[model samples]
Target: MAKIVNREEMAQGTIILNEIIASRISRKAKPGQFVILQADETGERIPLTMADTNPEKGTITIIYMVIGKSTARFKDLKVGDEYFALIGPLGKPTHVENVGKVVCVGGGTGIAVLHPITRALKAAGNEVTTILGSRSYDLLIMEEQMKAASDNFHICTDDGSQGHHGFVTDVLKDVLEKEEIDLVVAIGPIPMMKFCSLITKEKNVKTLVSLNPIMVDGTGMCGCCRVTVGNDTKFACVDGPEFDAHKVDFDELGKRLASYLDDEKQSLEAYEKANKQ
Candidate 1:
């Protein structure tokens, strides 16, 4: 069992961040890797990308939106509580390089996954520009931390409650036109990533996207986190949770992700009802 060392709520309590004591995983985790965690013996395994790792503290942080039953259970976990199971440092780490100029785009809770990668890119001596977005100002997270990690930072909110009035793609379009960009990294909802990839592809910028399809065992053996890249099937767990954005089949991934939504909703409802009882 992994002990929860710290917990914080963000995005108006819609998102939860937990720092779990996992010394080995914390020591080896990288920017793009994820962990599979179970709330209890009966809880379903859910994969969450690492938001940060404190090797000195022997803890790995994970930030996730409480979207379904598994995450709802995760949200109920308090500091000093122990997870039933936590396995990680999974997936291939992001290939951080000294690419000249990088624009990192994140949406919603994806900002958590993008955090460490942006910091790593900046540390590698690349000029990093980060664009983050959500529905409104209150929903935006890690703004100050993101700003510190990036050489340039911008915000976008759908309701015009924050920086740019439109999507991150709108700001990205402007940046692509005005600046010479060497690389682009986007992590968000599949649709957001898809649109960002479209823009970056048109600009001929090398782009990488992090994929989080439904995962079971979190290892290659499960074959559940499969994604098609460059017309070839690859497991997101072992091969990558990160892939060339231009080559990914986002449509298929979207469909696959939606496949279990009805079931998930039913499960959440039942769990809530049982809790009330």
Candidate 2:
């Protein structure tokens, strides 16, 4: 059982951050890896990227938006509560190198996943710039942390509630035009990633995107997370959650992600109704 040592609510309680005691995972987890956790015996297995890991404290922090039934269950667990199961630092770690000027773009909950990677890039002697976005100011998260991790940090809100007052792509395009960036790492909503990749492709800049396809078993055996990259079927669990942005089939991935929305809605509705009863 992984005990929740601390918990905090963010983005008006729609997102939750939990620091769980997982000594083994904390010790080995690297940037870009994820963990599959189950809230209880009857809960659905859900994969969450580690927002941060503290080896000395033997804890792994996960920040997730409470979108469906499984995440709702995760939100209900308090600091003292424990998870029924938590399975490891899965997927390939980010290929960190001092690749000159690098820009990391993140949107919504993807900002959480981008945090560690940005920090690692900066640590590896790369001048890292981070651009984060949300629909509105209130929806943005981890501002101070992301700022600290990046040598240059910018924010964008679709509603112009704060920061650049435009899409992250706007800031990215401006940066790309002004500087000679060696690489770009983008993680966010599929649409945001798709657009970012599109912009980078035009500039001929190397870009990497982290994918969050439907995953069941964190292991590659499930075949549920298979995605087409440059015409090859790749399982995100084993091959990568990160891929060359230009090679990803974003449209196909977007469709695959929505395949179970109706079912997910029904599940969340039933869980909410049952709880209210």
Candidate 3:
């Protein structure tokens, strides 16, 4: 059992947990790795990337948004509670190197996943510029941490309640035009990542994107997170959660993501009804 040593609400419907797991996995966890966790015996396994890690303390931190039944169950667990399963340091780590100027873009909960990578990029001697966005100010998470990791940080919101009153891509385009960017990494909704890739493609900047397609086992054994990158098939669990953004088939990805929507709604409704009784 993995014990949750600490927990905090970072934003509305989002929670961060500090968990003590086996030292082996924690020691091996890199900036872009993820883990599959289950809240209880009856709970379904879910994949969440490591937001941060403390090897000396044997603890890893995960930040997740409550989007569905399994995630909602996770939110109810308090500090000191134990999780049924916590398996990993899974997936390929972000290919980190001194790539000169790097632009890291994240939206909504994707900011949490991008935080560690941004810090790693900066430490690798890259000039990191970050653009973070949300529906509004209250939905934003990890703004300060992202700022500290980046050479410059820009914020955008749909409702004009934050730094820049526009989409994150708007700021990204402006930055790309004004700067000499060598690499761009974006993590967010499918459409947002698609647009960021589109912008970077014109500039010939190498871009990477993290995919959060529906996952189950979080291993190649399960074909659930399969995505098309270039012309070949790749599993987000084993091959990568990050891939060359320009090569990804965003249209197919968007279609596959909708496959479980009806089932997810039914599961959430059943969970709510059971809880109410």
Tens digit of per-residue lDDT, candidate 2, span 84-171: 9999999999999998999999998999999999999999999999999999999899999999999898999989999998999999
Angstrom error at residue 232, model 1? 0.4
Q: What is the C-alpha lDDT of each candidate?
A: 0.94, 0.94, 0.89
lDDT of each residue in 38-131, candidate 3, tens digit only = 9888999989988888889888888887767898788888888888899998999999999899999999778888999999999999999999
TM-score of 3: 0.96
Which residue pairs overlap in candidate 2's backbone? Answer: none
Residue-wise C-alpha lDDT for candidate 1, range 22-112, written one tens digit per residue: 9999999999999999999999999999999999999999999987889889999999999999998899999998989999999988999
Q: Stretches of candidate 1 above 4 Å error?
A: none
* Clashes, model 2: 0
TM-score of each model, paired residue for residue: 0.98, 0.99, 0.96
Q: Which ten residues in a row have the lowest lDDT in candidate 2?
A: 256-265
Better of 2 and 3 by TM-score: 2
What residue pairs clash in candidate 1, if any at all? none
